[model samples]
Target: MTQSATRSGAPERVGRFELLVPIGTGGMATVYLARTRLIADTYRYAALKILHQKLAADDGAGLADLVAEAKLASAIRHPNVVPVLSVEEDEPWVALVMEYIEGETISGLIRAARAKGERIPQPIVGAMIADVLAGLHAAHEATDGGKRLDLVHRDVSPQNVIVGLDGRSRLTDFGIAKIDRTNATATGLVKGKTGYMAPEQIAGLKLTRAVDIWASAVVTWELLAGERLFHGEPMPTMLRIVNEIPARLRTIEPSIPESVDEAVAQALAHDPSKRPATADAFRKILVDAWGNLADPAEVGRYVQALSGEKLDRRRAQTEEILDLRARMTTVTRHAEASARDTSSSKKAPGDLPTRLESGPTTAPGETGFASTGSLRRPGRTRALGLGIAALGVVAFGVWMVTRSGANVAASPTTPAREASSSEAASRIVVFSSKRPIVAVRVAGRTVESPPALTLGVPVPTGAHEAEVVAADGERASVSVPADASQVLVPLEPATSAIEPSASAGAAASARPTGRAPGRLQPPAKATAAPKDPGLAPPPY
Candidate 1:
């Protein structure tokens, strides 16, 4: 288990979702890092946002709002808009499950920068804002069935925009979104953050996509100014937004281009019609002003540099989770075995489920097998069959062991790796080979590579004899302690000489100075530690 696992006990289940860790919490909902199985035994990560207990107890009205948010966001399938998978109805608790974005919020990034007595690069900020606008435009132009959704994201604060580690900016949380077809909000009630709210929104006037346009402009202003664009109490802030603009905005960043300032000021125009006609227009203006700076990879680099420690801790915690899953699998197998043994002694024929009661119908006068009724006897024939099946299973297991070249230790020698505490359960050695690695023997267990390169293979921390054999009979052996995070084995064919890439060799040989940065070494070059365990934050 990772360190966090010991500190906070992992929740076994939250509805049908397996809660891995608590990622973030807000006034309306608490988000959890979770995983759920999809089709074909595949699993996907998701952010499960469940309404707070206090809110859920209010006759389910709050739950309805969550459902509405999911519905609204699900309809708009843009890359920049965070995707909502479903609204799960777990009894007594409803959750809005969204595509798990493995990255920090823009707000979190700003806070981290402040802590370091620095600011995010201006170009990066401009790029992120552009991405947000692109997503907002998609939502505005979304269609429901054959009709336009006419969706307006009323809440477009920094908290709502998630900058993923993959360097993409996604707009999330459409809980307060205004739709033409539905009226979830009352006519005169105000919504959205006070400082970022538009004049029309503050007055509870009829809203269009321009409100989002206005909020987006305010966010860009804050990013550049390094402070809130509007201040004071809520009422005063609303009045300021309604009646005035940031007169000192031009003076806030002397280095900012004049054209950029003029564009932002236009978007913040008090009159909605005077603002850019659509989010796309505003985005175009900003992109031109910023000029050739939107690289998702840059955002990815900044996030990794800022959150290296937090991410490492998460990775360590993930190891514990993987170990737990392995244990659960073992338990399930044992239970199945016990059930099969019990069924072998069952006396009642009716105990079988409805599907097993009948056999394939025989063609007219074609008798390849006995009738279903004739096979009902559970005495000598059944016992004999069970014994034969058990023997066959054992023989298969033996064959598998032999085929994988797993041999019991002839004599107890020195261990290969140093043993770690419970934390080691999550620590694994990742391997990437040029050729197909057919079998990997680690800690007395043989792991068969599944068509793809085996990234994370758990080996106990201590002296361990690890061996890798390729499909073409090429083999490589390594005696390494599990204490090291990763090990690279290049199983080249015996006849041909294999040359390793310089970068990969350097990465493998590089000694640890401190906690490494989040960027992984190129896969072709070196075998780096897994950035994310199978259920971790982001792939990159």
Candidate 2:
């Protein structure tokens, strides 16, 4: 993984898509949050991602690896792994549209915790590690035709993890990792975070499931120890990892048990076989070790010895306020992994798991679709989503039949073209924000837009309500009609809704202590209903 070069070509509208804002920049490409242009009458919201022109042109940009990661990750269904919502291959820059994670990194969380002179509780840390393992376990166990996929998380560290205020822990960034079943590493070059790298990994030895176990152990120690355990300072960190022994947990905190110290020391063992047999095993051990001591401050003298105040979402990480949005962003289930139909009839391949069940599976000229079997025709089956070509043909045919059957009584010669355009222009106009909004629809198709929002997308005509998803991975939809003009939607990390009550405290406070600027309102008096602050479209 060499540092990616600058992109070529100027930023310009590729077609009807509108680029929203720069989401982030990595060693390889600049990620932008964008929107797809909606039908002229239906201003529906859609997200589009573009590979930086320069990155797109690079032979080493590894398009195959990028697509492979998408395909692999798209198959797994763990809550922590961000899902790949869409993929567009043939383009100037191959764009991998995905369920964007809007939150900050675990590293950011650690930095915040340290600033507060408090450390994440051992149980929370253990749980966070467990979340990552659960994701890995799902990926590792994923099988295609009885063959185990045999996955390995090459990079497992705080930087790749995101812990949200909602108490959900997620594992992101699978692009750079490798799976034992499929060779995914970049040859002749090293990847993964230093200091967290296991002894075997540092020796340039081939990695296995054990490698991840070691990294997990190191991360667990970091969260519990409150400082870098391998080597605290500069170059020495990597050096001491190879030469010197790490300070024992008991030395740092006398209250620490012999088992906890031995467990960590054993996990850092030079031999992979000596480490915990699996991530699950390590998690169990730590969970037992942290039984009642989840919160360090509740413990003895060690708690007071810590300088910084124990803080949480509110005051621990001011720099991560923006990062919190990414972590807390909502999730959209549009790409629902289709479950096998419980019918007695013969089923199709899609009737089983593993197939990517996303978007409109309908054939040409259809409005609704069935997951299994062939496309159901107009009078036979209900399919959702048809292409413009087919819809146009149907529209033209319907117009012809209507014209032929119209009454002979006609009005005097008048400029009918101007009258039609004028009338259409005067119709109701509706729009929504980057966050999810529900719109009423008469049919699956959109009719005239309502006059609610001046920006965002207009709900397609004809439907009373449909789910609208944002790139950030959050989802919300309106069941009511667009005629309502404005909607009160719950939105977050990915634009989503904040429950009327989150945890025991948020219900009492009524305000997200760390929501984006003006994005949240102080919760009103005790009420069970979620508050909807007429949100303007996001400026992204």
Candidate 3:
């Protein structure tokens, strides 16, 4: 679509990769459809994603992010995730030769079909996107340590999904995808595609795995309804996300089954805690029952109704989901994939699956990813609740028993302040206010990219520090330490938490500019020293 991108600027060859043809281009880079010309045709094909020439300017922080993404993406190996083969920097372009996936984007498929007055098959659409969700789960769960890689496909939309000839749906374009735990983080412009964003992501809250699950739900909605789920050109789409309202599936596409509408509602639940916590969990909710988008006129009525008077599909669907969920059989889940099980935390009274994170708990009976819904004795709910409380005490005993003197010395005292708990790491310090601060280093540079300030991060030990670097790069802060085992550094209260929600509105105000970095002016200063991390003013 973008004219040839200049033949002169394009590379003749890259790491034995032939520049066969350019497939697509976005705000970040140009993707080329090409084949790998190895010594012997290993029967290889790959896509070459070359950084845009203008992006290399370093004027905006985008180039730095791309460079980091190249390194991060190349390190990850998964079938669902398009592999990054190699990276090289040319004079004018930073080129990355990657595994070229030969297929049409879901967006292209949708557009072609709509133009021809045709609709995509619902089951095929669901299957196509179901595979995409699997890929997201693989990336989200990928990790080298106890921490999750936490790769969030910020942009989960039709444009990023590819339906291959093999009928497998593959996800490409980590361009705007964010690896939350990585040392490098992207600020300024919002990451992710329009029409698909989680409420927290929309609010700029500390992003969790739940955000991706929420977005995946949106993408699923789009594919099944044969119409835009969060429809409203772009501005309205953002409002639709930030409004903290739930959308009904039946209204989005009347043909969708009632059971599916309920599942979709849970996936799109405004509260992150209410939504499926993991992609695997989300995938599990979707039985092959919810077919994909092949029905065209099914969604047309809703659009027509919108143009006239749309009914209360939004509110009705919410109640329906709650009613339908009552029929779902549920029991407390025992985590298996994780090394630590914190099922000690209790869920709010409800039958829907809820996530609970407690201080590290012990589980000698740990399995990689398998557990049963073994039931407890009937009419023993009160006793079971008491057991959980007692388990909290036992978990402490387990921690003390498992820890060695050296291990005790190595652990921090607080979530973000103390170097070691046993080493008297108990003094907690938080941002007197919510302001922009870059983490120069984290836990001897092995932890992960910490928040500008400690907000949602739980302190395993008593204290720890996030090395804050100054804006100009002239000097960095000595680590800001917090003594509390956990801290919540909320910047701007919930009322103002939502950014203007307009890309253009943010462009002039929050967009990284030619001036020095970290020039962001905090609207207010934090004062309350959170002995246990107190909340701060909402972020604008």
Candidate 4:
């Protein structure tokens, strides 16, 4: 890994996959460019989506939603849909391993075209939407045990459709999809993008496969017109979808064929019964109207024309990660052997289970993870702990390489002892203050304060200097105790010329507390006059 990569705090590995770089971040998870070794000198690249640590710890619903997404998406088998290879749950991390696509999202394509003052070709638009529709149709008609699953992909937009350089357009991100038997989405909760939602969906009516058709039509219209079909705030956008009539596609772009325009308009009909009954039927109609639908090869060429530089950069990054792996194989092997010895000889009572025990392969239902009673399967061992141990070993090796001048091949015999002591003795310094912190600088690194006011920085067992910056631009320097796990900083009011109170300053001087890291304690309600009234107090 490069120095910049290290500064970004990217992990070396998560579970069995080595993380290459971050690809994308969403509301509840982050997707990484990752690879796993298949055999000696052979590997498979993947887009690994891991749930956010904060969300996993605080919200059961977030974890349940991801589990539901993995289960539903993994069931569909289609060339036009991205495949989910596996779902992994190791404490502090739950990830979905997916086939990586090297290309741009339709959203990116649209933005690039708009910036260049060009509209996407009608045939390309037709072919891409047709491909998406095929995937949606397969999902809608999917079955388990010879019974229809009755799936509805509630979130279908340009952002969720990825167009690979290989000329294939695949539908992705089933995070908000609804399965009739599962009820993954809660009642009365609106989940999809406002601009692409169908009228019934915005109104909280029971959804059907037609919602996907409606969203696909909106994407088609945007591709041809180079503007959003519905543009406004959430409430107004919903109202426009429900009560307004969209102008004909040919009105915005007269070059578009009248037949194509009519087909898209029909699909955009507000009444579910008025739209095409199925995604496949809508696809066939659009393709026939297009008359000369571009093949995947042509679509791939167009995508490359718009995003060749980005694709090249991504390819280089992947190569670099692979090269780094090749160079570190010897060190990785040594670390793994050391971890195995440690695991066998010194078993800690609280250590995470070494494997995920497999039981029945049941589908996720209404209660999500609860329906399965646990995230783990009941019987057969799957070596999850081995993956975790490998991650820790790699982490220890990387730390050594960073500290000892990057001679990765040196010190084959040192990891076993160093890993034990360094891993055990490492302590976290949790910084807290009564004022809103903007950022914290420690050990030559500065990190913005998270939503939680408390910032925990892990350090070697030694005294360190911490600089805290408040939202009001007041700065304080404090010496953190080598042994103290928690410390409180003091800050004076922005308007005050006086320094912080003596008692507060005394508290700031290396106060130790038994509070656990990453747990937010409730804050007392403030009754005094507020200076930065717009900013809410951190939930501790």
Candidate 5:
């Protein structure tokens, strides 16, 4: 596999995914453009959302939520919903691998149109929202073992809806979704955007599928009206959602048909009972009101027209990664075959070592290498031949390293001896840390490190203080041993004060990065009931 460099120089490999570039970052995770090689000459592109190391280390809750999102999203198999392919947990990193959608988000489309002093066409908005409602209907009615899931997508803002270049809209990011099987959000702790939340939801009342309907309607309203349905700071937004009625779509955008305006108004009613009972019901009303919907092909063309340049750049980057992967695979295969052939030729006749009985090859979804059992043959000749073959392979490895212009130590696995003051500065010191490091500073130089399982930083052999920085902003320093070639530094766990909620607000307010499929908001404090009922602390 190949590795890419982030700005922090983190090695971008999580499980089998080779992260190409980061598409989006939120409070809990960063979504990357990644791919997995199924076999030689075959690969599958995916959006790999990796939980931040600090968040994953904070507690088990973050990991559990990631698992829940995978399970919930995977259960609903529909065209309008993005699919989760797999979930991977590799120590400090937990990731959700999903089918990569190549297109603009609805939020992005809105921003582009606004920049040009335009609005999304009424028919296009109707068609896109219809598809989103279809996806939500599937999620709401999904089942497990023939039992109803009672799923509610708690977060369904424009940022969470992606319109692929194929002209299809797909709903995604079930991070804050509620399902009957999992108590994802506790009582009193509100989750989701303040503006899109239903009156009942903001009041911390019981939530149902109707909440998604309210959010969907808000998105539809913004698309047609070219303005936020509820715009203000968090507290005020919540107040407006709970205490005020929204202006009709036709009132703001005169071109909007009266029927479409009425349908959206019904869905945005203050009381759940007053709104459409289900997403399907609301979608039906919208379709009937609009009468004619934009074709998928037509929607795709519009998306391309607005985002053609950016899409082309992303497409070029993907091609470069695929090409690099192919080249690396060819080189690795050639090296392995060369080593095997050279070792085999050095063995004498009838002196072959014990043959390993082959077992099942690495299966799909399995990580790492396969294991085999060796059938031992009782003979000193076999042992001697094996020793010779091992020496030959080692020699070949050294030769290869030398040919690549790298210094070869006496032993491949051992570090080189520290160089004396009189000796040339050919000796190297390797620095490692217990935690994933972001960067290392030694000998008046700072080197960006990877977020890999094990970190190793090499510098010219010397006595110096090395400072290391972890992803969570934890820092530690170690004094390098003058005569040693390796040093291990330990960093204490992150302080409890580094709350995930601290950055949640900023993440929520920031524009959608790339094709991220979710809106991450701060965990809302459970508001005191009108009757003053006490509640537990908000879940960070």
Candidate 6:
């Protein structure tokens, strides 16, 4: 909750992580879209979950629980499990920096589908639940010093499962997970979403991994039926879960097969022993029932169809945040240079260093350089102005060199050695889109596009095809010679693909009109799919 302010008034950067924007505020912590200072000119984004000061102060054990969550998640490594990259134990706050899943939660997806007058397809639901079970099993099997940690994810609600565009479902948020020999969940205290809680869990009985199994079944039931399995206030819902007889899956939806219904019924059994022995067992049954229809590619296609426009906008916003990082660096360097110059100036003996309040003021929308009238002293002010002007000139030159259609060639009289070096240099291809957000493909492979791109990248000295695809599936492709380093990609508004036989009106009418819903202040670079940091890495 504390802001980092250097003497120079630069944007806050916590340790090596630069906080971009606040994306969420929850009961336990505030999540930020943040990036690491990996190396010079290289950064990776992550979700920075910082514990609220009030929560830490009010409940001393709350902070420990958050740290325990990070440690526990770090121990369980699996593709389906969201990873914790690092932890920060600094003053005024403690943070759990984790791999940010660049996708919507299952709850978000379900809401979107409902809004579209669509039910989540059964196969997709099966695949998603299967993924969650797989992750839970990994955690359950996690061991420390050759002894099983006996982990049980107490919270397995729709909100904790993220469905990536690649059709992968990742389980996140282990804050309330129960670990053996630890008072993480406490014996009698109830935790987790009411509708997803197991019957045993509501009774405050000693828990086992079966609680997670029951919760998963509840999620499956909800997904298949398109309604909560249990409803009403917390007490009413808990009572219903304990007393009322559960409905058969087929009763909610007739299309659901009997085998699937039987499997879910067993998973949602009142007694923990009656439930499936393990998460893997439940997953196998669901996978078999769903069959080949639960293909990842199909699920991926469904997700892309629903979220393409939002993803495009998200990628653009990510680029802008990265761009801001560079600007922040520039401002920091400029401030330091001004400070140094002020310090080294000829001054009276025993005088204090000249203190410049607010450092330098920048013109509206202009970064890196400052406007006139920042410093009061004539000589020092002129020097600062000159330095800023020189930076401006360099920036202008860079812009000109990177602009689309700009060409530069070696002189015919250039030395042979220099010519070889130029040939060896990696050719860059800058992909530009006329539309604010468009996906660009190079050689049929998806690539990240920069925001407000002007410079074109150099390509291998041969002919290459560049494709610009809109969120609506409208695409345009162009061929360019390898020798031509820079090319402008004109991306028009998504229109119907022209078919040789069908009329343009027919094509237009066939196209989907559903635009992916806009975000309510979403994260730009929520890092997921990060390289596994070993059991121990340097804490932030």
Pick by TM-score: which candidate is best?
4
Model 1 per-residue lDDT tens digits across residues 288-392:
887867588988898888865455545444444454345445544554575587466655655543333455666656875546443344454465676666556
User: Candidate 6 on 412-471: residue-level lDDT in tens?
Assistant: 122324224444344544443333322344442333222222223334555666654433
Tens digits of per-residue lDDT for model 2 on 322-412? 2222222211111111111112223354443333334445664575544444433331121223233334443454333223211111111
- RMSD to the true structure for each prediction, in A, is 16.7, 20.8, 30.3, 20.7, 18.4, 18.2
Question: For candidate 4, which ten residues in a row score worst on lDDT?
Answer: 1-10
Clashing pairs in 5: 11-450
TM-score per prediction, in order, is: 0.59, 0.49, 0.50, 0.62, 0.62, 0.61
Task: For candidate 6, give the lDDT of residue 139.
Answer: 89
Error of model 5, residue 535, in angstroms: 55
lDDT by residue (1-540, candidate 5, tens digit) is 111211122234678877665555565676777777888957778898877555666667778788989999999999999999999766556789998988888988997788678988888888899999999999999999999889899899998998987899999999889944443344344778777889988877788999999999999999998999998898888888888889998878888889999999999998899999999999999999999999999999989887664454445334433433444345445546655655554545676565655545665457564544435444544456666665565456544532321211121212345434543352344343333344455664444322311223345644666666554555666666455443444543333212111111232233222331221112222211121123221111
What is candidate 4's lDDT per residue for 1-540, written digit by digit as tens?
001110012245677877665566666677877778888967778888877655676747778888888888978999999999998665566789999988889998997788678888878888889899999898998777788888888889998999987788899999878844443344444888889999988877888998999999999999899998898888888888899988898889899988888989999998899999999999999888888988889999999899875554444334433444453565568666866655565544455655554456456674364333334421112245555666677777655533332212211212234445654455445554434444465654443422222444545577666776655455667666564444445442243222212121222223233433332222212222112213221110
**Which is the winner by lDDT between candidate 3 and candidate 5?**
5
- The per-residue C-alpha lDDT of model 2 at residue 217 equals 74
- Candidate 1 global lDDT: 0.65
- Those runs of model 3 whose alpha carbons end farther than 4 Å from true positions after fitting are 1-8, 40-44, 145-147, 179-187, 244-246, 291-540
Off by over 4 Å in 5: 1-10, 179-189, 319-540
lDDT of 2: 0.47
Which one is best on lDDT?
A: 4
Task: Give the per-residue Cα lDDT of candidate 4 at 172.
Answer: 95
Residue 426, candidate 1: Cα error in Å is 26
lDDT on C-alpha atoms for all candidate structures: 0.65, 0.47, 0.49, 0.67, 0.66, 0.63
- Candidate 2: misplaced stretches above 4 Å? 1-19, 30-53, 179-188, 230-238, 254-258, 292-540
